[model samples]
Target: MNLQDSAIVQQFQQHCSLTEEEKVLLLELEQNPLKVNAGDIIWQENSKVDQFCTISQGWAYSFRNLGDGSRQILKVYLPGDIIGMRDFAFSNRLAGVAMIEEGIVSHFSHEHLLKIFRHSTALTAGLFAIACRQQAVLTERLIYLARRTAQQRLAHFLYEMYLRLGRIGAADEGRFRLPLSQEQLGDILGLSAVHVSRTFTAFREDGLVLRDRHRVTLPDPEALAQLAEFDGGYLNDAVPALFFDREWQSHMLAGPTARSDEQMPGKSKAASAD
Candidate 1:
């Protein structure tokens, strides 16, 4: 697939305006691809984090291997995702990454990324926006795992995947290719393999899903979304700028000393709703 047309590139454009030069930089970053096989461990946890890679083809996932020989799947990757950014501030990998299926990846050095960060503010902000979206997904996962019911969790996950895959036109009319196994789904949702199977049966009987091998087609996406209690608002793709002014400058100068309590970022954001 062309790097210019990849999901990450399109997503970056959604978050910020990109110059043709910046677009070329993105293309250059994904050059010199290496082919990988399904089940290949791309990198082990605790490995040096001096480099990151973009998924040029196929699918992959990051996971933590628990002491009991089980796994907790952290993030699923589709084509165009640049891996290793989560560990950019660290010297070692935070989680192990593996190929879910045969794919290709292009490795780039941290030094090169730093150069891009310095040279392109637009791209840098775009990257930051993308990272925030990833963080939001993890935060939502934490919430659902702690509070949502099994069916709710499963519903939410499927719906989320549908939306994400839809970005690249991989999903339409509620149908999409799910490259994950029942065991992998269990790991992601903290369920047993049997539980995943049973839940799939329940979903089918309830008219929530229609499965044909690895492809799932939601019969009634709206109804399924209601059952999932899914708030897709967070998935909205935009990174509008906050135009600071003299009042904001005064707040920066005085809020720290005069009214420190108002200086919280979340508080400022909420105040902007006015």
Candidate 2:
């Protein structure tokens, strides 16, 4: 696969209209690619963090081990995701990343990324928008684990994956290949493997999804979305036009000081209405 034509770049292009010159500059920043096999650790918690990578193909996940020795999956990384961007402000990796399937990732030094930031306003804005979307996904996962029922969490998770994969042109007719095991799903959704299996059975019995090993088919996306109480607003693809406004740009440059309080899943206005 062409690294330049990867889904991550396509997604970035959607948010920022890059000039030919800018595209060349961005391409130069990426070094040789690395091949990761299934179960390989891409980065480990507390490791030195000097570079970020873009997933050119396959899937991976970021997770952390709790004090009790159980793992909490932070987020699932689909093809085209920028891994390690979430920990840009930190000196070391805050979480561990591991490949779920054979994949390719291209690394870009943090120094080179900073150089790009200094020279390109549009690219910087695009990167910021991508970071915000990553944060949104994490927020949604927090909500899923804390307040949503097992069924709701599973439904919402699958629906989100479907939309994400669709954005990358990886899914068709609501069908996609997800290589995660039941144990991994349990880590992500805070359930036991047995519970995850039972939930999958429930979803299948309800006619929401059809499962064939690693392949999943959502027969009725609309019905599934309703069941999950999913709102796609959190997955907005375009950056706000107002971000280009001078005053707004200045405000963003000043940086955010405080983060929003964690949101309860069913407490949001949209969720309450459902």
Candidate 3:
């Protein structure tokens, strides 16, 4: 997929008002989107950071290596998700993000990004919104880890993925590929690997979901929602709490060139929104 045509970049434009000059600069960077394979480390924890990366296809996860030699999966980033935006402050990597499947990513220098913000209020606000959204995701995840049960945690994770996949038009009406392993799942959900497997087996037996290796099918949507206590309130596009600015919203829906209804089910689309 061409990075320039990726929905994430389009969303970024809407969120961070890109001027013609900034667009031109991004176009140059987008022309050479990087391809990465599963298991490849995109960045290492504590590594010096220079470029910001936005996921265009497939999925990635960020994690920290614990002193006990265990890795904790912190966040899963899908298409349209940008990582390391927080590191723009310190300009250094504090953790690592690795691809979970084959994917495309675009990287931009920190200096150029700062330049865009320096010259444009709209761009600055858009970037701020993106930062806020990331913070929101992180906060919600923290709450899930601290307060939710194992079953509820798993359910909530699935529901979040479902909504995100639907947004990018990459999901089957209620199902999609799960690009994670049992161990990775355990890390993200704060459960043991064995516990993750057992919980998944229970989900399968209950007929709420079906799983085979890296694929997951949500067979009963309502049941799954109830299990997760998913109100969809956390994903409200119209909610100002997610950090969308009015100007960015206006620019996105202002023209036909704005967001398009993503094609779904069996059609191959770039993984930007997931």
Tell me which of candidates 1 and 3 scores higher on lDDT: 1
Q: Give the candidates in order of lDDT, highest first.
A: 1, 2, 3
Whole-model lDDT values for every prediction:
0.82, 0.80, 0.74
> TM-score: which candidate is best?
1
Q: Model 1, 1-274: lDDT tens per residue?
A: 5556765577677676677787878877777789999999999998888789899788999999999999899999988688878888998898999999999988888877887897776677678878888899889899899999889989999999998888877999999999889999999999999999999999999889989889999989889889988988678644455321123444454545656456543336632523
Residue 258 lDDT in candidate 3: 33
Candidate 3 local lDDT, 177-225, one digit each (tens): 8878888889998889999888988988888878887778898777887
Q: Comparing 2 and 3 by lDDT, which wins? A: 2
Q: Flag the better candidate by TM-score, 1 or 3.
A: 1
Candidate 3 global CA lDDT score = 0.74
Q: After superposition, how far is residue 263 of candidate 3 from its true place, in Å?
A: 44
Where is model 1 poorest over a 10-residue stretch in terms of lDDT?
A: 242-251
Off by over 4 Å in 2: 1-4, 242-274
lDDT string, candidate 2, 162-271, tens digits: 99888888899999988889999999999888999999999899898889999999999889889888877789644665333334433444544534543332223322
Clashes of 1: 0
Error of 3 at 118 (Å): 2.0
